[model samples]
Target: MQDIIGRIGMRKAALGVLALAGATILAALAYEHIGGYVPCELCYRQRWAYYIGIPAALVAALFVRSRPALAAGALAVVGMAFLLNTGLGIHHAGVEWGWWPGPAGCSGGVQVSTDTGALIESLRNGQTVRCDEPAFRFLGLSFAGWNAVISLGLAVLAGLGLQRFARRHLAAV
Candidate 1:
């Protein structure tokens, strides 16, 4: 495993990051649209890193041969993004598990409005998705838990790719 990881060049590493990030986002979308999982505010927020990292990874892959330093920088940035995302995932999972409180807006609670008009309006607006609840889970892990695991993996991959790229290309400079 170490030899295989060491052998992977910057371009391959970036491409691997791109592929994984893209697939993860696609699966999230599929879960929402096809699997009938309605995402909470935190769930939407969790996707931002993937949205940014995917393009960055692609650019890094494209430039790895011609501009190795720039590619390495992009990979570094992508790694940081994934690292932050991993934190967010953990926070969200904690919220779902009742380990910590989530944001007031999306956390589970019903606000009572004595005004009949406001109550009717809220009912018309449909249900509010709660961040403290998991829309789906497999085995013992919720979507947020799985996301934490995946984001950490991506971050490590990006770091490894950057390290390999730098050792191979930057050392010559």
Candidate 2:
């Protein structure tokens, strides 16, 4: 098994990372498109972490298969991704609880006195997505809430994978 995996090389690792990334993206898309969830500004910011993570993981996979790089990259990607998500969760929670004002442009709680026409246009375009609103839910929490929990789990798993397979990988290659 070890020999087979060794032969498979970084290509396999890249695919695995990509697979995880793809799954994450698909889940988000499903939630938004199929499930009819509208994402907020912070939610989009969290998604940007995914965008960076997937490619960085791919490049890290393409490296000389160093365990440290591979494992560290895996951990970093997940960590960074989760970090962004964590912020989003806190912000969303604040929005839900009204702890602080959300982004001025969106959040619906923001104040603007430009004109009735501009206000109407902004409302019509949905210019700013709000954090307070619960667009969709899987259990009881909103998607941002769910992302906070799930990303934490994924980060831990990535760390474990680095600790486990990473050593053998470094020795083999």
Candidate 3:
């Protein structure tokens, strides 16, 4: 582990992690843009973590020279992203199962006015977040379901990478 960390160092590893994180973001974008998939509220929530992780990795790589320390920062960011995605996935799945309510802002606000014209306008605007709907699926898994699996795996990778750095740089392993 230590040998790997010393060899790759902070900058390279951080760059690599950031690159992977970017790839995931791009993939999600493609799913929405090219694949014509829409994101649910939970999907957007998952994106928040990626946003955080990307900056964390890039900044740590750029300014932080110490490999182990920088890796820790990067891992924390990515790991948080992963955990958040996992939670979103679970929550979305629950929503699909009618377990709870999703955020009103993205899902749908309470219909305040009962005017027929206003109702028609809202319908025409196509303003719905449809938390029950799964926008895309991979191997029969919805985006949220797949996110749960992939994000957990990514978290493991980040942890291993960080552990390698710590063991090599600090533990003399």
Compare the candidates by lDDT and give the number of the best one: 1
Provide the clash count, candidate 1.
0
Candidate 1: deviation at residue 170, Å?
A: 4.4
lDDT of 1 by residue, 56-125 (tens): 9988999987887788889988999999999999999999999999988789566678999998999898
Off by over 4 Å in 2: 1-17, 64-75, 97-100, 114-117, 164-173
Ranking by lDDT: 1, 3, 2
Cα lDDT of model 2 by residue, 1-173, tens digit: 65643453334544554676669778998878998777888787768766776776666565635555654665567556756666777677667666777776567867785899988886787656677676766667777777667556544444444545556656788
Please give each candidate's TM-score. 0.91, 0.68, 0.74
Candidate number that wins on TM-score, 2 or 3: 3
Q: What TM-score does candidate 1 get on C-alpha atoms? A: 0.91
Which residue pairs clash within candidate 1?
Answer: none
Q: In model 3, how large is the Cα lDDT of residue 46?
A: 80
What C-alpha lDDT, on a 0 to 100 scale, does residue 96 get in candidate 1? 96
lDDT by residue (1-173, candidate 3, tens digit) is 66664465455656776887788889999988998777766788888877887888777677655454655776667767777777777888776656787777655556556898998888898766677766656677777777777677656656665665676667764
- Rank all candidate structures by their TM-score, best first, as comma-separated numbers: 1, 3, 2
lDDT of 3 at 145: 79
* Model 3, global lDDT: 0.71
Question: What's the C-alpha lDDT at position 113 in model 1?
Answer: 86
